[model samples]
Target chain A: MALLDVRDLSVTFSDHHGRRRVVDGLSYSLDAGGSLAIVGESGSGKTQSALALMGLCGPTADVGGSVRLDGRELLGLPWPALQQIRGQRIAMVFQDPMTSLNPYRRIGGQMTEMLTLRKGLSADAARTECLEMLEAVQIGDPSNRFTQFPHELSGGIRQRVMIAIALLGRPDLLVADEPTTALDVTVQAQILRLLADLRRAMGMATLLITHDLGLVAGLCDEVLVMYAGRPAEQGPVDDVFARSLHPYTRGLLHSVPRLGRDPGRAPPARLQAITGSPPAAGDAGPGCAFAPRCAYRFGPCDEKQPEFAAVAGSRRVACHLESPP
Target chain B: MTLLGVEDIDVVYPGRSRKDMPVRAVDGVSLTVDAGQTLGIVGESGCGKSSLARALIGLAPLSRGEFRLGDSIVRAGERRWPRRLREEIQMVFQDPVSALDPRMPAWQIVAEPLAIHRPELNAGQRRERSMAMLDRVGLTADLAMRYPHQFSGGQCQRIAIARALVVEPRLLICDEAVSALDVSVQAQIVNLLAGLQDELDLAILFISHDLAVVHHLSQRVAVMYLGQVVESGTREQVYGLPAHPYTRALLAAIPDPARLELPAVLDGEVPSPTDPPGGCRFRTRCPHAIALCAKSPPPAVAVNGHHAACHRRDELTRPAPG
Candidate 1:
């Protein structure tokens, strides 16, 4: 059985413009020790979908549909029940470490408090565990760093501390939302490798949400490509990248400049840029959300939304032009 | 003479008080940009790429050295830039939304440069020029009345580019100009810049952290590390045969889906600039660092017209192990 199964999860916010659905009928599942990535551009509802699954969407958001963890329904759970599952069952690594961490408290103090409160460990026991967790995340001289505040450390170090704190409860699943976006390329590589290593060492599943398709290819086992809050394509990373069925996915690949082209060969005269921007939330109207920008958009794509259907082996794509042979 | 020639330029932020150490933001950097050519300055954050760009435009005071734009020689420590120099060089900043004024409409913002530099032009002429510039940047004249908030990121960036070019500056200094835009939008801006450069015969000092974007747009590339140009060559030489370890690591670090092979990751964070290491600034994180690297800075060596500041440049540039 899958460790986390999401069925038609939708997140809507009620404003003066009525209820606008930002994440519309998103569904995916991750088995124990599996990694899945949700790839999309800004305003694609990638972050909101992850928030909905974690029940972290605040009071204004109305999350619907079923989120089953180990075959237990998570939707409509009370505050106390959701709180218990939050850190203990699933943890999250946010985008910016500076804002996510408490600026006033020392790193050790934060970790110890969480350990004592969540795990019922004694104060002394929590201190020991905190030190171990810091070392586990590869922070050298944890004893010295334990007393330092978040501002005292560099951006890269602070991110590592955030990862350690998230894994303190030994959650079964970890959801990282653009964890490396704020970092430099060298620091980003370190963080990615650390996440991969820690995930494997702890035998936990990962739900990585990012905008970079290259990062998805490197870190994820499977990928769910979202376009304007809808899943455009989903399959194994290698298979999907090798032969993407959706025009949106292909467009994204074509736009990014790949490194290490032949030295003397000129780069493409011009990039094949997607012409239009994504639609506003709840304003996609009746047809396919990506039809405005999709090069292969057809008549049905303009008239009706295409449902996700099986394509080539183990892949599913939502496009009017795609069908299984 | 080169269109823009910078010789050993340095920018230092003096210590606020006795206790604080001076921060050398840009140290002894030199490069040239020919007419209708783009010289890309690539580096990670805090490596002083932006500071160098600021120095070139007189925003940051250069501590030493000299730079020439066309026939004029601008020395360090000049309190005020000449009007001719200011009119000849323009800059486009990274943040499109913040860079533009909230109260001003797109047309007024684009016309402001002309209003200040060319007071002889009447209001109608300024308006007509602004509309023409907007049209050149692919923004229709009808949208000129809209404010920055009304426009998307890409549209706002186009407006910014139009403003920078309306003065008809010979040199354009763009510091991470398209970094804030989406990938598709970024490509559009890049293509627009390339087109404009050719049409106007402008020289560009393009500073960005993105290696691929730099490679695509630049004719020559300079890799900066710890406020110094670690390597510089034609785009082909720098990208094809990087001589500096830092440059090689940076190129390798790019997440290329076509090349799934893992990059030879450089360990540790960039060292603090205020209290940089004794010798080579990147020695702490360099994979090929030796005892000599910690004793003295490496001198620049020329290899097939490429200049790299590394003690082990030859060995590092050799064909990689399988």
Candidate 2:
């Protein structure tokens, strides 16, 4: 069995407006030491889905469906049971490192606190493990960094610290939400490399949630493309990127300016911009959510919502056009 | 002729105390942008690209050097900008939502420039011009009555672009303007800016950390590292054959799935501008740094009509060993 298996995962929130579903009927699985990327733009519920998996979604959100790790169901567990599993079996690294970390506490204090409380390590032993993990994340002079507060470190360093803390628990799975979005291109490369290396070294499964397709290509083995509270497509990263059946995926690929294009030749004067914006949650009517902006959208796309079905080997697309003739 | 000429411009922020060091955010940078030309400045965070953009439009005071817009000249330490000079140079910032006034309607925000620069026009005339500018930027006439919060990120950027170009400024400085936007929306705005550049013959100082975006719009490119222009050349010259190690590193760092290979990551982070290393500022992180790199600042060497400030420019640019 895979290390992490999720089926029919759904998340909804009830506000003054109405009960709006943010994630709906999403299913995927990741084997031991495998990596999966949840790719989407803003309001795509990719982040919310990951939050649901971690049991970190706040009181406002209503999450459903089965989340199993090591043949054990996680959904609807008590607060204490969930807490025991969190940061111990399944760890998470958030997008913004500054806000996630405490400004007042030194790096050593914050990391050691988690270790002592969760792993039942002594203060001295936790300190030693913290230093080792810091060095493992390629933070130079871990000893000095231990004494410094979060404010004293750079964005990249703080992110590395977050990764080290996540790994200190020796978790089986790691969920990173837009880990490199706040960083520069060079720094982003470093962080991605660090994550890839650590995942390989520790034999851990990773669920990387990001908007950048380029990131998905390098770091992930499988990909789940989300749009407007639903899974638009899911498959091996190479297959999804190379032969994307969904119009949204194709539009996303065409939108980004790539570096590999020949500098000597003139680039396409205008990019294939996806006209109109993504629909607001629950604003997507009974029909297909992407029908409004989809270039290849047809009669059925507007009349009825498409269901996620197997299209090719290990690939599933939620598009009416993907149906075999 | 160059519509905008910047010579050895330096912007320095004063120290907090006598013991503290003042930061030289932009140091001895020189470049030019001709009429209807786009000069893209590419750099990482804290490399002073935004600082340089601010200095060009007189938002930040230059500690030294000079700038010329057409025939008019503005020297360093000039606190007050003449109205004519101010009207000729406009800027579009990165954050579209925060850059605009939330309380004001979209038309009012776009027409505010006319209110400041072209007061001779009546309120009705200003409104017409604002609506026309809005239409040109792809925003419909109906959006004119809406406020910033009502518009999407891409639409807000269009409004911002409309506001900047309403005055028909000789030069437009976009400091990471499309960085906050999504990939699809970013392309739309890029195309919109390109179209406006052709229509108005406006010189653009395009500052961004994204190499691909810069290459898409720029006629010429300048690569900044630690408050200095490490390399500057025509788009083809710089992008096709980068000379400076820093520039090469920046290009190589772009996440290209087509390439599908790990980038040659730089060794260390950018040093604080306040206490930058002597000689080459990039020596700390440069893979090609040698003993000579730490001794003296690298001279700008000219090759194939391009300039790169690196002691080992030739060696770095040489063909790789078989």
Candidate 3:
């Protein structure tokens, strides 16, 4: 069995706006040492996917479907039972390190506490290993950094600290949601390098959730492009990037301002902005969700939902046009 | 005659709280732009790009030196700008969501600048003119009735662009205008800005942290560091063939999937602005820091028309201190 397997996982919520399901029928698997990146726009439900895993989804998140870790069922596991798996077996590094880390606690204290609680190591031993882990993440002067609070460090240092904290106990799976978004351009490169290194060194399977395809193009092995709480396309990074089967994925990749492309020549951009807004949850009634904004939608796309079947060249797209491949 | 002549314009942020130290936000920056040319200002965050933009548009008071919009000097406490000056210059902020009045519709937001600049216009004329300006930014006339919140990040930016252009300003100061938008949206906005710039014949003081975006858009580039122009040159000269170490570092730092890693020249956090290093401010971090660096600030080492503040100008022309 794979290290972590999520089968038809769905997440819903109820508020003043009625029942809103953020994540619907999401399924992916990862072996012991693998990296999968889920890329999407702001409201494309990438963050919720990470939250769904490790049982971090809040009370309002009405979850259904199976979440398996090392062949063990986790869907309806009690909070106490799930808590044991979370942070110990699987860890998460949130987007913003400034808010994720406790400002009051010292880095050493936070790192040591996790080691002591999860792995039952002595305080002294935990401190030693944490300092070693900090070094592994390429944090300078790890001994001094241990005593420093979250606020004392720069944005990059703090993120490295967050990564170190996540890797303290060496969890089997790691879910990093836009870990480098808040960092400066220079620091972003450093943090990404660290994540890539540690993933290889520690033999940890990782799920990197971010918006920047450029970052994923270099770092991630497999790519999942999500749209309106569902995966629109899934395949190897090079394959998906080279031949984006879905129109939305192609539009997203072209939209990003890469190093090339003269900014001066104002070409009348051909953006497939999907004429309307994202379809709301429970609104995907019997038809393709993307049909509303799809530029090339024909009669068949609007009438029925498309299957997420395999396409040619080992790729899969959840669109009617590419379903036959 | 220079269209906009600013020489040695300095802005010092006097410490408000007792504990905080005074910060020299922008210091001794001098440049002149012809009436119909765009000058792109590129720098890292906290490099005083916004402060320079604020001074150029007469929003902030100059602590020292001179600022002239044509022949007239911009004086302190003249916050209520004169009609002729107000109509000629306008500023667009980074976040259109907060910069624009959310309670009012798009037409009213664009009309606010029109009313301020051309008070003589009646409500009917304002409405007509605002819709006309909206069309220039590639926005539909129907969007005039919708609120800013209803639009996407890109559309909200178009509304902001319309607001800036509605006054028919000669110079538009865009402070990270498209930085917040998505990449695809950024290209659209960039296209819109270019079309408007050409049609209206306006000068632009484009400010941004992203070097690649600046390289893509700007005609001429000026790199700033700790409230001063560390380097200035033509777009190809500055971005393609960089003069200053800081400029090269800024360009190298931007993530480019197309280009593999170049020899990186910078490391560590941005030095604190409050207590910037004495003499050459960048010396503390500059890889080529020597004994002379702590003694005096480096003068602008001249290129053909370009300039960079570095002691070892000869070294920059070489392999750039690998």
Candidate 4:
């Protein structure tokens, strides 16, 4: 069985404006030691989809569909059961390290406490294991870092500490949401390298959530492009990037600024910018969510939604267009 | 014509306590922006890109050095800016939403600059000019009556651009202006800025951490590290043939979809700016450091104005034979 399998997942919330489905009909699977990336802009419900799988949704949120981990249905699991699976079977690292980590507690205390409580290890053993984990994450001086608080460390170090904390349980699946978004460019590269190393060394599956398509190419094996709470395209990263079938996917690929292959003195060519912004959440019109922004949008694009079905060359795309332009 | 010429400049912030050392945010950085040109300043956080921009705009304390815009010259210890200089240089901040006042309508927000800078113009004329600027930035006249909260992130950025350009500034300093925006929206704004610059013949100082965007928008690029310009060259010279080790590492670090292989990763965080490394600020983290790199600072190695501050600039960046 796949390590993680999610089918037709949907997460909705109730407010004064009525129910709004932030994550709709999301489906994908990942095997052990594999890496999958969910790419989308903000408000596309990429984060919320991961939250739903982990049973971390708010009280007002209603999550439907099946979330199976190792053939076990995780959706609607009791709080106690979900808590047992959270840090053990699956772990999550957020975008911001300062807010996610406890500022009042020392790094040693926060890290060791989890091992002692969950793994039933002794104080000395827990401390030893945590120090080893920190070293594994490439912290130059783990002992000193253990005594310091989150504020004392740099942004890159704090993020490493967060990853170390998540690894305490030796989770089978790691859901990292924008892991390097808040970091500097050089630091971002370092963290990504660390994650890739850890994934290979520990043989853990990774579900990376980020807005940068460039990031997906180097680290992730598979990519799922989400738009307005729906999967627009899904396939191996190389194939999808080479020949994107969906108009939205094509537009996004063309829009991002890339360093030229051979630099020249000529002015930069204008980017192929999409016309409009993403639709407001739950503002669906029983049609394609990307119709308005799509350049190759046709008659049926506004009247009916396209099915997310498999196409040639081992890819699943949701668009009226049959093949690459 | 040299629209903006910034000589060796420094920005120092006093320490909080007696024992604490003052933070030297920007140290001895020099560059020039010609008329109708875009000069991109690329750096990591706390590298003093923003501090340099703030220094140029007269917001931060310029501890030393000087800068001249057109015919006006402002030196160290000159706290006040002349009225003409202020009108000639304007800035657009990082966050589009917070950069604008929520209470003010779109037209009013754009007209606020005109009210202060061009006092002779009546309110009607100010509104007319503001609306025209808005239209040029891709915002409609109908949206002009609405407040900032009513607009989307892209629209808010357009409004911000409209406001910055309404005063007809000769130099526009965009400090990570598109960093807060999404990719599609960022492209739109970039195109808008290009068009506007051509129309007005404005000289722009674009500061951003995103290398790809910097390469796209800039004619000349300056790579800053620990408040110093490590490399300055044309976009081709900098992006295609990076000489400084820091610049090379930075460009290599970016994950490019076109190139799927994981590039070299830079190790260690930036050293504190308060007490930077004595010889070279980046030598502590650079991969090609030797004893001399830790003893004295590297001198500028120049080739047709494309220069890099590195001891082994030529030896390290020799083009591989085909």
Candidate 5:
């Protein structure tokens, strides 16, 4: 069995407006000690998918899926049972470290709480491990840094602290959502290296969620491109980067500016812009979500909702253009 | 002559605590911009690029250097400004939402620049100018009455661009203007800025922390490090063949889709400016650091058209100190 298998996951939100399925027929499996990256623009439901995996859904949102982590069903697991495994079995590091951490709590207190409460470490042992965790993330002067508040640290440092907190439990899975978006390129490199080293040391399965294709190309082992609310494409990072079939994926890769190009040169050619705004979740009909902007779209793509189909080796695209199954 | 000339300006942020020393944000940095061109100011956070851009526009107080627009020197460190000095330089801040007042509608925000500069113009003429600027930025006049929260980050950026252009200023300083937007939005804003540069024929000082963005938008690029211009050259010279070790590592660090084969060079996080290294600020992390790097600062060495300040400028150095 895969380390974490999410099969045919569907989540819908409802209000006085109507029923809207934001995540439609999403499915993927992560192996132990492997890494997968989800790349998409904002409102593409990356964070929402993460939340579903955590078994944290809203009252009006209906979730139908199979989520298994290490042979345990995670979707229908009870709250108390899920909480028992939340920090210890599957940890998560959110995007914004500044807002994720509490302003009033000291860094040591947060780190120690996770260790003592989740890992069953004693107070004294937790304290030692807390310092060790801080040192592991390469924070200079861990002893003094433990007493500092979130505001006292820089964005990069706070993010490192967050990583330390998540790694304290030594969870099998680590889900990082845009961990480096708020940082500069220099600091971003440091954070990416730190994550890579930690993952290797702990042998953890990582799900890196980000909008930057550059970082995806450098760090991720597998790439899953999300568009609208579905997986537009998935493949090995090298393969996907080499041959991006979906128009949305193609547009995203082209949008990133490259170095060494003349500044005054005309901007790189943008493929057909995915022309219209993202379709509302409730308004999704029986058609490819990207049909409105796709240059190769046809009647079949508009008449029926496209499903996942294999293209070349280890690559899958959700479009009718892929030679019929 | 360049449209805007900044002659070796030093900007110092006032000290906050009694024991705290005054922070030299922009220390003796100089650059010049001609009409229909762009000069990109790039550096890590706290490297004083924003301070330098603000000082050039009379927003940030300049402790020493003077700014001359055409032949007139715009006075620094004061709210009151001469009419000619005020209209010649305009600034676009990082946050479009806050830089533009939230309570008022978009039209008035764009009209405020004209109001302050050309008070004698009639309402009809001002409205016409505001709509023209909006159209030039690819924004419809219908978006004029909408509040800031109603628009996307990209559209709000376009509004900010329109506001800065209505005065018909000779210079526009953009400080991390596109950093907050999404990728699609960032591309749109970048293209819009490039298009506006052609239409208005204005000189722009674009400040950003992203090297790729700077490489795409600048005619001439100046890399700053701890309040100093560590490297400066044309886009081709700096991005094509970087001289400074920092510039080389920074260029290598940019992850391009076409070139994923090159190994990354930059390693540790950028150190804070409050307590930088003693001699050469980048020596602690310089790959080719020598013993002399600890004793004295490296001087700028001109290689062809590019300039870099490194003790070992000839050698191709990585990010890690050997």
Candidate 6:
């Protein structure tokens, strides 16, 4: 069995205006020690889908469908059961370390809380383990860092602390949502390297959520491109990024500014930007959500939502085109 | 011709208490931006590129060095910038939504610069220019009256761009202007900036942490580290054969899918600006640091029209000649 199986997952939010499904018909599976990345622009439901996985969505959110781990269903579990599963089985690290880490508490105190409470380790043992995990993340002078607050450390160090704390529970799965978006390129690279190393050492499956396609290739084995709460494409990172099938995916690939190998060559005068912005949450019509922005959009695109069907290899695409463009 | 020439610019922030030493956010850095060109300044956070931007605009304290804009030379400790100089330099900030006034409509926000600097123009003329600028930035006249909250993030950014360009500034300092926007929106804005640079012959000091975006827009590039220009050259020179260890590591760090291998990340964090390392600020994290690198700051060595501030620049680039 796969380490994680999410099938037909949907998330909706209701208000006086009525109900809108922010995430719809998302399905993917990850093997043990595998890494998968969910890439999309804002309001694509990438973050919402990950939130639905952890049951971390706000009270206004209504999540449906199935999420299974090791042959066990997790969609409708009670709060107490879900709480036990949270830090013990699946840990999460957010983008902004300053916001994620408690400012009022010391680093050592925060790191050991998970171990002492959930793992039933004594205070001394948890401290020693936390120090080791900090070292594992390659933080220098782990003892000095332990006593300091989150604000005392630099942005990179604070993020490392977050990773150390997340790994303290030694969860089988690590869900990182835009973990390096707030950091500088060099610092982001360091964080990505650390994550890759930890995954190798711990054999943990990772569900990485990010908008940058550039970031997906190195760390992730699989890629799932999301658009307006639907799966636009999915396949091996190298294969899918090498030749994206979906029109939306292609547009995104062209939109990003890449550092060309031939640096002496002049950059293109203009990026082939998708002319229109993404549809707002709950604003997608009955037809394809990305049809308005798609260059190869056709008659069938406006009439009905295309089915997510298989393409060559492990790739799947949700577009009306008869073959890959 | 050089539209802006910065010479040994420094921005130091006084500490909160006597015990805390003042932070030298921007150590003596110098560069030039030519007319109708983009000088891309790239570095990680706290590298002082933003401080340089603010110092250029007279927002930050210019502790040392002077900047030459055309024939006029503005020295450090100038209390107020000349009115004409102020109009010649405009800025577009990172967060588009928050940068705009929530209460004001898009048209007024665009015209606010005109009202401040171009007072001779009547309200109608300002409105006319505002609509034209809005159109130039891909925003429609219909949305001009709408408040910031009504527009999307991209649209708000368009409004911000309109405001900056409405006055027709010669130099536009974009400090991470597109960093907050989504990739698609960022492309639109980037294209708009490029198009405008040609149309108005604007000189842009584009500062961003993302190297790819900087590589795309800039003709000349300067790599900053802890408030100093570690390397500066044409886009082709710097991106093609980065001499400085920091520059090479930075370029290698970009997670480009076209590249086969994973990025080679530098170890350790940027030391606190309050108390930087004795000689080189980057030596703590630099992979090619030598014993001499710890004694004194490396001087800039010109290599094929590119300048790198490293003691062993030639040795590192040409470890073994062909």
Model number with the top lDDT: 4
- Record all residue pairs in model 4 with backbone atoms less than 3 Å apart, i.e. clashing: none
lDDT of 2 by residue, B178-244 (tens): 9998776787888888888888888899999999989988989999998999999998889888888
lDDT of 3 by residue, B207-294 (tens): 8877766765677788889889988978777876776777767666666544333224367767878888888888876777788889
lDDT of each: 0.88, 0.89, 0.78, 0.91, 0.81, 0.90
Individual DockQ of the candidates?
0.62, 0.66, 0.35, 0.70, 0.37, 0.73
Of candidates 2 and 1, the better by DockQ: 2
Superposition error at A297 for model 1 (Å): 2.3
What digit string (tens of lDDT, one per residue) describes model 2 on residues A1-325? 9999999999999999889998988999999889999988888898989988778889998999999998899988889999888998999999999999999999999999888998789999999999999999999999999999999999999999999999988999999999999999999989988999999899999999998888887788888998898999998888877878888888888888876667644467777788887766657888899999887778898888899988768999999984431
| TM, every model | 0.98, 0.98, 0.91, 0.99, 0.92, 0.98
Write the residue-wise lDDT of candidate 6 on B1-322 in tens digits: 9899999989999889998799899999989999999999999888999999998888889999999888777888888677778888889999999999999999999999999988999999999999999998988889999999999888998898889888888899999999988888789889989999999999999999999999999999999998899999999889988889999989888988776456888887777788889887789988888899999999988877799999888788885756
Window of ten residues with lowest summed lDDT in model 2 chain A = A259-268
Tell me the deviation in Å of residue A86 in model 2.
0.7
Ranking by TM-score: 4, 2, 6, 1, 5, 3
Q: What is the lDDT of residue A221 in candidate 5?
A: 87
DockQ for candidate 6: 0.73
lDDT score for residue B198 of model 1: 86
Candidate 4 lDDT score at position B211: 91
As for candidate 3, its clashing pairs are A255-B183, A255-B184, A263-B216, A264-B216
For model 4, how does the per-residue alpha-carbon lDDT over A1-325 read when each residue is reduced to its tens digit?
8999999999999999899999988999999999999999988899999999889988999999999999999998999999889989999999999999999999999999988998899999999999999999999889999899999999999999999999999999999999999999899999998999999999999999999988898889999999999999999999989988888778888888887466445545687788888876567788899988887778898999899999986799999876666
Candidate 3, residues A1-325, lDDT tens digits: the string is 7988988888888889788777777888888888899987667788887888877778888888888899999888888898788887898998899998899999899889888887899988998899898888877789999898899988888888888888876799888999988876766767777788788889999899987777786667888888778878999888787778987777666655555644333323233233444554445656777777677788888787676667787677888783322
- Per-residue lDDT value at A177 in model 4: 97
Model 6 residue runs over 4 Å out of place are none
Error of 3 at A312 (Å): 2.8
Candidate 2, fnat value?
0.50
1 or 3: which has the higher lDDT? 1
Candidate 4 Cα deviation (angstroms), residue A211: 0.1
- Which has the better TM-score: candidate 2, or candidate 3? 2
Candidate 1 chain A weakest lDDT stretch, 10 residues: A257-266
User: DockQ for the candidate 2 complex?
Assistant: 0.66
Per-prediction fnat values? 0.43, 0.50, 0.21, 0.64, 0.36, 0.70
